[model samples]
Target: MRDTDLSVELCGIRLRTPFVLAAGVLGTTAALLERVARRGAGAVTAKSCSVRPRRGHPNPTVLPWEGGLINAVGLANPGAAAMVGILADARRRLAPLGVPLIASVFAEEAGGFGEVVRILEEAEPDLYEVNISCPNVAEELGMPFAADPVQAARATAAVRAATRRPVIVKLSPNVADICAVGRAVVDAGADALAAINTLGPGMLIDIRARTPVLANRMGGLSGPAVRPVAVRCVYELSRAVPVPIIGMGGVTTGEDAVEMIMAGATAVGVGSAFYQRGMGALEAMAAEMRAFMQEQGFGCVSEMRGLAHGA
Candidate 1:
């Protein structure tokens, strides 16, 4: 493990290692984020912030099922203005370690996306992950914005115009055509893409209380169950667009990260795994990835990207 070459340079940013802390996973506080970075994340993504603050949904917002978790966090966070300060503090704290900070932002409309992007631009994160697909939001917006090509493009374009930072559009697996949305956003100006946000507005009922497990009634499903679907989406996106893909869904182990890379992801995002195994999962995944690559006679992650595209 000590001699494994697990490092990668993604979209011009050099990552000491390939494992990144996905959004909403220990990204709230600057101290916690620095700790995760010190624990061995190549980079960290902050939770989705918007132009306005949100209290999000009530208690019982997350449920751990047999193989995964369903959550309706509803993008709870301080507004973009407040988050910028946090991002600055994190960047300053992690500077000595040279870890990159990624800021993720979301909004209900294209204009709001632009506004949030502008507000966050002041924080100067290493990159920006434009989240257009949160299944836990209000019903009035209908499906996730990433589900529609027109909406995806509009939002992506707004953010692109607002910031010079590399923008990665996060897509939803619940869409009818994930590739279509990917193409739309990339065409609009996304520098990269993160495939397969959670799946399903799934539910779990509490028979005793005669109510749903989540206060929101339904939530997006994630974990091992969605890894296969994520692989398929990343594989398709690799062929559909020329941008580097950040693959996520159920990456809990190094083997899972390997599978994602072989499926065409330049980098792997581990979110649900945090809930399943805590921060230790990041190191475990990296170790597993190194072992698999070494055993397979591969020297670097670039060599394995898209290796499973046609297979």
Candidate 2:
């Protein structure tokens, strides 16, 4: 066995590995969350839920492109109140595995964010990831809250006030200045941040039928295609803010996670990778990270954080 340690601490929460099962990937149930935890995920985030249930987009919601995947799943969920049972069960399942359950919440308005948080507090999640960045819901919600510093802060502050859990604000890459948003959320009471929620609200056309592949027409691009952007956002945020960051985008391999860490991410989020590499990807990634660390003569994962920032 390699002597390298993959454990990481994010906002006082100790993670056995830096690999977090990013929100939205089979995150709707306690069974799914527990499955990922048993498979080696250090932490798992539940799907983003709102005050009320969402129908979400219809068929062809996700598609794989040459680079990665493009998705417009909309923010469909069972809603905060409905998810309490699932989240509570998930927390129970994950607790035995020594994994933390992160509940992600969103809303149509700033105050709605707190209302959702309050409803879901019964689950007692280890952390709350305020998803102010989902691009798929822009059409319904009117320009994602993450696109504006004021809106992002408002949403974050609402969540902070509703729960004592660590609030990790999820930011969008479609913004003009992610660092500004990062700073805003931090000042408003974010305990940590998750960057680059997806690149563009891009679209794909099915030339044969002359129609869009996704039912929603446009969706956020993710996977390897957006990894570079994710790294840049985390790098800038680490410099601009004084809180931990969860960097995610196109991260599929152990080396990818290591790169994210070097870019200043305290933890790396893995979502599309599960679809691309299966649930086993987490264990594989952790192994890959350990091998890389050993080969590079590093003793722990923290040693790789922000190495890219050095001259």
Candidate 3:
């Protein structure tokens, strides 16, 4: 962490590193987040949980594609009520490392977001991360909640009203105008933003089995394939919204993380990369980012953030 000058402050929470383990990866338990933090992540977002315990989609929920991987885990998790103990354990486990536990919540309905927030409030999460748009849910309307400014604002407002904890709204990239959605959520009281959730409700065919590879038929696309689009979203939203952005998509390496930061991400989310390179990926990214900074003669992350805006 020393070589990079990677420290950053999101909303009011401070992080020793700018590398965060994105939601829905290895985020179910406090132990997992603790392990990642000890390995070198600045923070970790627990898997997205709902008001009710969900089974999520069936088998073949995750598939490795050519460019990246597709997943429809259905946001499976113990309900918020059940997560209270888990969050408490996570809060305790991360306290020593000084890593913040960002509890990610997803609800089928707008009000449900607030309900889950209230449930986890007692657990004392360092931050509340609301997942307004997950492409895997079949029940969603024409677009995910992050696509509609109205829906995004409503959800953010619900979570904001429910907790005093800093709130981060993770937006989706499937929308035509993600900046509008980001701005709406910010106006609704989101303290920070995580740009570009997985890109598509895409699917793959099991030619050998003569059926769809994923049981859900479609899942969000993530990994190297989405980096370009993710960077674009971060770049645009960085200029449009005033809050900090946690950029993600295909950040598999430290250089990739640097690209995201230059595109306007205050921090970077390492998701599918977690699977591709394993836990060592975080450390690798930090070292690589530091080397890049040294070569470019930049003193810190802030100096490079949004550097692409003018380009």
| Top TM-score hit | 2
The parts of candidate 1 lying over 4 Å away from their true place are 1-3
Best first by lDDT, ranked: 2, 3, 1
Candidate 1 per-residue lDDT, tens place, 1-311, comes to: 33568888777998878777888667888898898888878888988898989888898887789879999988889998889899999999988998899999888787789999899888889999999999888574567788789999999999999988899999999878888999999999999999878888788998999989898899998999889999999999999999989999888889999899889998988888988888688887777888888888888888898888655
Candidate 1 collision pairs = none
Taking all chains together, the TM-score of candidate 2 against the true structure is 0.98
Q: In model 2, which regions exceed 4 Å deviation? A: none
Candidate 1 to truth, TM? 0.96
- Among residues 3 or more apart in sequence or in different chains, the pairs in candidate 2 whose N, CA or C atoms overlap within 3 Å are 223-250
Cα displacement (angstroms), candidate 2, residue 114, comes to: 0.3
lDDT (CA) per prediction? 0.87, 0.92, 0.89
Candidate 1, number of clashes = 0
TM-score of each: 0.96, 0.98, 0.97
lDDT pick, better of 2 and 3: 2
lDDT of 2 by residue, 145-164 (tens): 99899999999999999999
Q: Find the 10 residues in a row with the least total lDDT in model 1.
A: 1-10
Worst 10 residues of 2 by lDDT: 1-10
For model 3, how does the per-residue alpha-carbon lDDT over 1-311 read when each residue is reduced to its tens digit?
33558888888778888998899999988899899999889899999998889888899898887899999888889898888989899989999999999999988878889999999999999998889878988554345788789988999999999998899999999888898899899999999999778888888988999988898888999999999999999999999999999999999988898899989999888889987998888988888888988888877888898888776
